[model samples]
Target: MYSDYHVHTNYSDDSTYLMEDVIKDAIKMKMDEICFTDHVDYGIKKDWDEGPIEYLYGQPQVNVDYPKYFKEIESLRKKYPKITIRQGMEFGVQVHTIPRYQKLYEQYDFDFIILSIHQVNDQEFWTQDYQKEKSQQEYIEGYYQEMLNVVKKYKNYSVLGHLDLMTRYDEIGNYPFEKVKSIITEILKTVIQDGKGIEINTSSHRYGLKDSTPSRDILKLYKELGGKIITIGSDSHKPEHLGAYIDEAKELLKEIGFDSFCTFEKMKPIFHQL
Candidate 1:
């Protein structure tokens, strides 16, 4: 059985699909479990336009509606027992959003949380529209440093959403990891130290990154560093994308020496042997 813990619903301003739409797709895919991780960007700078890429009509309070969202998920969970459904969120980690994230952590009982780095300072560095113009080395470096801070500050999150999400823009062309591996390793070491999971985000394939977020080499490195907690996700924002290529993700993890994948319930992990 497999579980996709990173997914989004209408609650994410960018998504127009409903929670039930996601559930129905999960059923079609014969997925064992799925979590709804809608977008919850805590602090986005107002001068976002000055950044590399242009964002569509600024996302607002994808975070605030969680209380109501939780109620909806709870209702869906009861109705969709054939396929396990859980509550989770994908949080955009800005350097200054930790306090708000911590406050949310204290109040909610979620199945999982995936912390992601979508912006570098105010830049929409994760998308190609902007990253294509920046130096690959510089963009990759910023991703590591920013992610390190996130792992250090948020102790409760289950996984780091997409370790090399900067590739979403393809601007990270032919960027050699040799010069940057140390920084990546350092950030991963902190994640290991903090006892969190790093996800194998399959969405990278959709974005044209040869290796899903964090590349296979980095996955090996994460494993070598004794960073044991790992999970797999499609990072699907739509129903059709919900369980896309999960079997491929399973194969990739095994090739990387992950004998099993993880699932979450009440904020705790339950490993399933592959």
Candidate 2:
């Protein structure tokens, strides 16, 4: 079945695509399943109720309004019964933020959750705050090290979102993959051993990147390590971005020796043929 497992709506601070509008677009795209993985970066943003609304990059920054978000999801599920809609969130978890995530995990019954490292020590990558004052090796290694540390402590997620995400914000250029290969291997092994997976985020195409978000090398290494749980997503935040490049992502996975991709329900993986 065709599916886009990572999506964003207005519930996310960085997006303004309305929830119902996104669902309608997914249905028009003939998507069989769609999961709303909105952004919730604990270290960089605040919850809707925690305090006054703040602004980031010209957008009002606020985490998902849980009470209203779930209410709307239920309403939409009934309003549009054709597509299989799932509730999910993208938690931007840092090593120090594990406790907050664990507590949030116990409070919700999400169908899926994407573990992401949007920042480290409250410093964001897009702004280059985390990468400044460090050599390429230092920043890259630090990013992977944080991932390793977080996965070692957090188990409430279904898959790691955009495994090599820091590269997207690196203004210099793609660093040598071999330099961070061992650490990435360790991260993947930990994720696989913990019964977790990684997502092939299609946003790389939108960004005009030379490879997939995690890069082909990482995908190959994951296969070599016998790590099989995989999902594909547009990581869309706009109407034009919705369900973009999904077919190409599937083909790339097939070329990499992966025969199936996954969708999630109640935090469990359900595989589908490529």
Candidate 3:
């Protein structure tokens, strides 16, 4: 089945594409299913008194309006009967934000949730400010350390989104995978042990990277470690980007010795043959 699990819509503060437009585009592409994994990041600003700020790619990053979001999803589900639309969220996890996210999960019924580390100690990695004071090694290592901490503390997610996401914004260019392999192994092992999975984020090509997020080496390592739960996503924020490079991502996983990827229903994994 053709599916793109990681997608953003106008509900996410960073995206401008409307939800209906994204669904229509996926339908036109002949996708069997698509999930709206909109962003819901906490700790963007220290004080609630401060107004919205441009924290993500120069866009004002705000938390997802859950009530309105789910209501619209229900509307689209009936509006588009031919394709399956799943309710999902890309939760930017941090140690301090775990409690808030836990409450969110308890309140809503999500088909899937992608645990991601977008900020370390409230400092966004996409901006150079976070990297300014640390050496390249320190920055990369710190990112993984935060990821390890989150996986250890939180077990409410379906998969870890873009396991090596820091690479996309690393100003020093590629840090040797060997430099962080040990911690990454621990992170992956922890996720797998917790019944969680990882996603092959196809946005790497769109961002001018030569490989997908987490890279081929990481994917191979996960397979070697008996990590079977995998999902492929375009990480699309626009209509034109929907389902982009998903076939290539699936092929890459197959090359890495994975026979199938995954889909989710009510937070449980459903395997699909490649």
Candidate 4:
């Protein structure tokens, strides 16, 4: 049975695809379980001095209608009993947002939550803004250090998304891999120690990165370190992107000595053999 746990719907501000579009594509792909992990980006609310409550404003909401989204998925699950449609969230874990872990965890009944380091102190590394100042190697190193902080701050997510996401932009600048290996390994060790799994995201391939995030070399290092908790994701934002290049990712994992991937049910890890 093929299960894809990482998928973004209209809920993510950057993605505009409809949720059903993704589900239909999953059916075409013959996936046994398709998790709808819409992003819920929480930002600090601007409040005036001496306010009664901490006014939580600037919370970005795209297709983030959770109630409607879940209702639709629940119906789809019943109709297509063959497919398990689990609800999940992809949280952009920042320093301030990290403290709200308890509230987020308690508020939602998510089957899986992918804690990703997308922003550092309000600076989004994904955008071209940060790239102007940091070189490719420096960018990657910054990401790794932010990951170390994000992973250590909270024990909230089921897996870490795209351990080497910076490579996408790195390709443009001819990233210095020789300089990143040590810091990458250091972050992976902390993830292993903190009981979090790394995701072999296929989205990198589709993103024109020509390879998976963290690369096969990094995956091998994780395995060699006695780290068995590895999960695979397509990171697809569109319906057509569902299960995209998953077989290639699976093969890459096997080549790196991983026999299976860890799945989550109610936020708990479960291993499925490759």
Candidate 5:
């Protein structure tokens, strides 16, 4: 039940946390399980062996080194038998990147895959490259529309990571949820119908947000719409962030009327009582 489903290691370009060190930290935190959901944004990042690598924001911008990543995970499992480790990757999928993700899914025996929209049309949100020029409605609509399209075409993921992720990068403050209610409803409906779930990312607390990553409103809507599967993650990239606010998140879910939360193994969900 105490599982951190979203974590990053040195394999992800933006992280420098060693995989072994992450395992040790999880064990110390009394975490029952942890998954290595490192980044793999094909449209924006290159695979480790895919020719010459380039640097971005102080690190070599490269996807997971598949061979080393899997090898180390296997090694760590045996070395740290007290804590369960699962293999996963965060695919920052865009509409055009679906094919690449599908190929990756076929190549690896992943326990989980977080389908995230870190960027759309190869432009990143954190950098404001995707939202700078477009009007608020245009960019908001564009973001959700791209997500809807991605969910419609992509089926390899276990859950949608940080459903309202754009809010994190939005410098304009909270955009009215009612304004994009219809599209959000469509996106959630598609996810529910496809048997996928969403995660309540606790990183919102670290970011000092007004609510959880998806916001309480979205979580309630998902419940009202008959969506069952949900997972909670700290989205940790550092030791201090590991397993952060997980208990608080579970409390929040209980407040929202969710009696159970999920963990994945071989891409199948296992529910635990809240």
Candidate 6:
């Protein structure tokens, strides 16, 4: 079984799964470990006064309630001793949000952190509103350019989450990888130099994507660039999705010349043989 490092619970505005239920389900599925990496995007655009809203169009602007989040996880830790439960956060880092994230790092003791780029200039790429403004090449370049900036500025994260996440929401279908290869290479180089890594987000398969985020070609490039640190995650938000396709992700890593995958404790990488 694989350790699912990217997961969400009720603490995240988007998810409804209670933390305890997530733990119970992970145990039932025979997972070795699980981490709660709920959403923490600082500048998410939403009408907070409004009650419930749709995600594809209007994103909920919310942050994790750190005290309650950690408190519940600690209780779950003692309650479920057999499985390792790690405390983590998926930080949606924009160039402007770096200072806020720095404060968050200092305020909490997280076992892991997955730095992700969900939006740029406070505009979410998932929505058609943002996508309509730019051409395919323009949007793709803009996404990677923002990511490169974030990677260059932030060093406290364990790995980059869904490195090519824009592809999942691209209405125009696949963008030519060659167009962004040079910039992607630069981003990977920065991450490796900072001793950071990337995750193989298995949710791509669930989303009917043809390849994993940061596809096999990008994974191969990372390996060739001497970037060895890699982790696998389901990016699961519900009980049914827990540990989904994790074994297949590991096998994919092995085929790409990665003999092992990584886990984290106190933000330090630990390799596990595949």
Alpha carbon deviation, residue 192, candidate 4 (Å)? 1.7
lDDT of 4 at 87: 83
The residue ranges of model 6 lying beyond 4 angstroms of the native Cα positions read 45-59
How far is 265's C-alpha from truth in model 2 (Å)? 0.6
The residue-by-residue lDDT of candidate 2 on 1-274, one tens digit each, is: 9899999999988888999999999899899999999888887788899999988678786789988898999999999999999999999999888888899889989999999999988998988989999998888889999999999989999999999998789888989999889899999999999999999999999898888988999999999999999999999999999999999999999999999999999999999999
Worst lDDT 10-window in candidate 3: 45-54
In angstroms, how far off is 107's CA in candidate 6? 0.4
Off by over 4 Å in 5: none
**Model 6 C-alpha lDDT per residue in residues 95-194, reported as the tens digit of each score:** 9989989988999998899999998888877665567868998888998999999999989999999999998899889888888999999999999999
Each prediction's number of clashing residue pairs: 1, 0, 0, 1, 0, 0
Give the clashing pairs for model 2: none
Instruction: Score candidate 2 by lDDT.
Output: 0.92
Error of 3 at 170 (Å): 0.6
Tens digits of lDDT, candidate 4, 1-274: 5878789877665577777777777788788887777775555322122233331134333325666767877787777786778888777777677765657578668788887776666565555555667666566677777778777677878888877776665546546556777877787788789787888888886778755686777788889887888777788887667788888878888887789887788877788898
Structural similarity to truth (TM-score) of each candidate:
0.89, 0.98, 0.95, 0.86, 0.98, 0.94
Tens-digit lDDT track of model 3 for 135-214: 99998999899999999999999999999898888878889989888999999899889999999999999999977787
lDDT of 4: 0.73
lDDT of 4 at 260: 84
Q: List model 1 lDDT by residue over 183-203, tens digit each.
A: 888888888887777888888
Q: Give the range of the ten consecutive residues with the poorest summed lDDT in model 2.
A: 54-63
Sequence-dependent TM-score of model 5: 0.98
